[model samples]
Target: MSRLRIHRFAFLGDARPFGDREVIAEPREALEPRVRLGERPTDGLQAERHFAADEIGDGHGQAGIERRRGGRVHGGASISAHARARPGRAQKSAIPDNPRRKRGGIVEVPFRLRFAFAMNLSLYVVTVLIWGTTWIAIKWQLGSVPPPVSIAWRFWLAAAAMFVLLRAMRRPILPPRDAWRFLVAQGFALFCLNFLCFYYSEQVVPSGLVAVVFSTAPLLNSINGRLFMGRPLRQSAIAGALLGLAGIGCLFWQQMAGHVDDRATWIGLAIALAGTMCFSAGNLLSSRMQAMGLHPLATNGWAMLIGATILTAGSIAAGLPLAPDTSPRYLAALVYLAVPGSVIGFTAYLTLVGRIGPERAAYCTVLFPIVALAVSTVFEGYRWSPVAVAGLMLVVAGNLVAFDLTRRFFVRTA
Candidate 1:
């Protein structure tokens, strides 16, 4: 081996000369010249790798290339002296290391990090299950209560519960003035008009079908974001939108085809479509609010209150009685919708948005339709035809494509 000098800071020994291919593997305490080392030099300290002059280089044996480029090589490896060097108060030295863990040592996976993954997974499950089942709960409220009045009760209870939760968590309940206007828009679109459309639509169609329709919100958001916010539309999003639209068409083929079935089927589809548009609009407003430094939870609480107020006022003006249904099932459904559906589900999903990312958290939209449809078969006595099954497949496939999950999985794994 060609002679080469490897410089290591003060380890457990004096300045040592590295022989050809000699590896001085040991616990090393690196210190600056004439500067005292810290009390815990071992804190996050990594090992230094020495290499023979012939060990690292291109085919032409340009081992000094790194040195010529103001750095040095290590152990015939890609990691260089300049790459892992940490600057201390007095001295900086090159070391072979991993930012996530120490090199050639214990892989320090933190206990909290493992739990963090579990917690996020739990949040995703709860959000999907609760939102999906709430379709049946919405259907339950339809028998006795007027749709507007029922929604008012749900949001009033939900708003109160959400405010209490925010207080317990010590988050500020009132949003900034800038966020209030957007909150109003979000409330109308998300809480009031969105639910009103769905509630009315469900009165005519199966609740599970409404969920399949609502699953198109992501596509709607993509389209509206492009139209209103000037975001570039992706080709995949367009393809997904076309597939989802075709699926909706198939789901209502007989009804829209003007056969002998209920005429309200087509009307229900239109209403659900309008509601999805409102939902997509609300999502954009929420994005704007988030950009203004508002937490979605805070805006959601305020929006629920505003939406409840609007629904109550609208109900009174329309001469609908404000009293809630006295039946046990109705009351139970109301509480479930208020607490778990709106408050808990929203909290979990938004938490996931913050933790995993809005992109991944929104995948919950893809899973909940299956849960809703499954619940529908048992409770609503909804029979799935071959066409309906095909529609469901298309919708799910479109969501997967729209989300670019294939690309994402490959990117992460790669």
Candidate 2:
């Protein structure tokens, strides 16, 4: 009698999604791991389903395995794979880990902390750096074009490129029908109104003041997350956010000084606040979409398309010319903003929000000023003052606190 071995599997049916499960079975090996649909009927016990490996790791994607008794299935001992196409490819069984698997007697870092943190950090850095530098490009996009029209052009190009990229990768471009309503809300808030408010606000207020207001995003996200999503208010995240806000204010203190009593200044501040709220709302929407199994690329692509259309319509109604600026500076900035700033930046950012929680991820807004100032220093003659240097340290401190990075290295592992 040949013995059957269980390779990869997940528990099917109900609340247990894929964390810590034990199936009682000398599971069959001929059952391909990747083929997720398998029902093992028991003698009056609940029907059990198995999957090979899935996204939660050890395999790939989401899957589950239910506990069985004496390693037997219903009235039968085993079953074959359900036909999900594999053209002439042999299935490879993974090696089982040794009970005492150890690396030189040193425990390894937890995958949740180790792998997830590293990837999230990379995404976070890319998002901050790309968006930060885009301010300069946005400045280039300003003259000879209405800011709204320029923004419309940026998103049109961004959405087009994003769809092309998604098609090349064979990822789904359309979200579920249920998702479009939220997609519209997200497109309006994040892509359309957010940019419009910011562009207009910057005209009235000092850019630094606008940035200072924008830095409040993490706090607002935290509050909204707790109220709407029921996510807990983390002390460390709040502390970090407050610290980052202070750092940002210090960093831009000089530039931020202006006629605060001016009516236009107050209006600009109000507009900046509205834009920040829109941004926070978008963050929440992205989280919700991810929970719905919608990828950031898909959501952003759709949202960008919707946003561009809306902006273009509004610009047309406002009597702005829908002409393109073909100057080298304008074209270069448009390309950079469309691809790197909008596409890459938003995807990386929203993905981070899904992984790290919105509050912690919104801390990226705080870091934006640091990168923007650095770029400004190089290209626009920005001089760093002692206050600014102190501000930089505070911002760094805030990120450390926000991420809670220290505990991972010193984590007590078994």
Best by lDDT: 2
Estimated TM-score for each candidate: 0.65, 0.76
The count of residue-pair clashes in candidate 1 stands at: 0
Q: Candidate 2, TM-score vs. the true structure?
A: 0.76
Predicted model with the maximum TM-score? 2
Least accurate stretch of 10 residues (summed lDDT) in model 1? Answer: 53-62
Error of 1 at 179 (Å): 1.1
Query: The CA-based lDDT of model 2 is what?
Result: 0.72
Question: Deviation in angstroms for 295 in model 2?
Answer: 0.7
- Which stretches of model 1 miss by more than 4 angstroms? 1-123, 205-212, 237-265, 350-366, 378-396, 408-414
The all-Cα superposition gives candidate 1 an RMSD in Å to the true structure of: 15.2
lDDT values, one for every candidate: 0.61, 0.72
| lDDT of each residue in 123-151, candidate 2, tens digit only | 88999999999998898887789988999
| Candidate 2 segments exceeding 4 Å error | 1-113, 406-414
How far is 24's C-alpha from truth in model 1 (Å)? 43
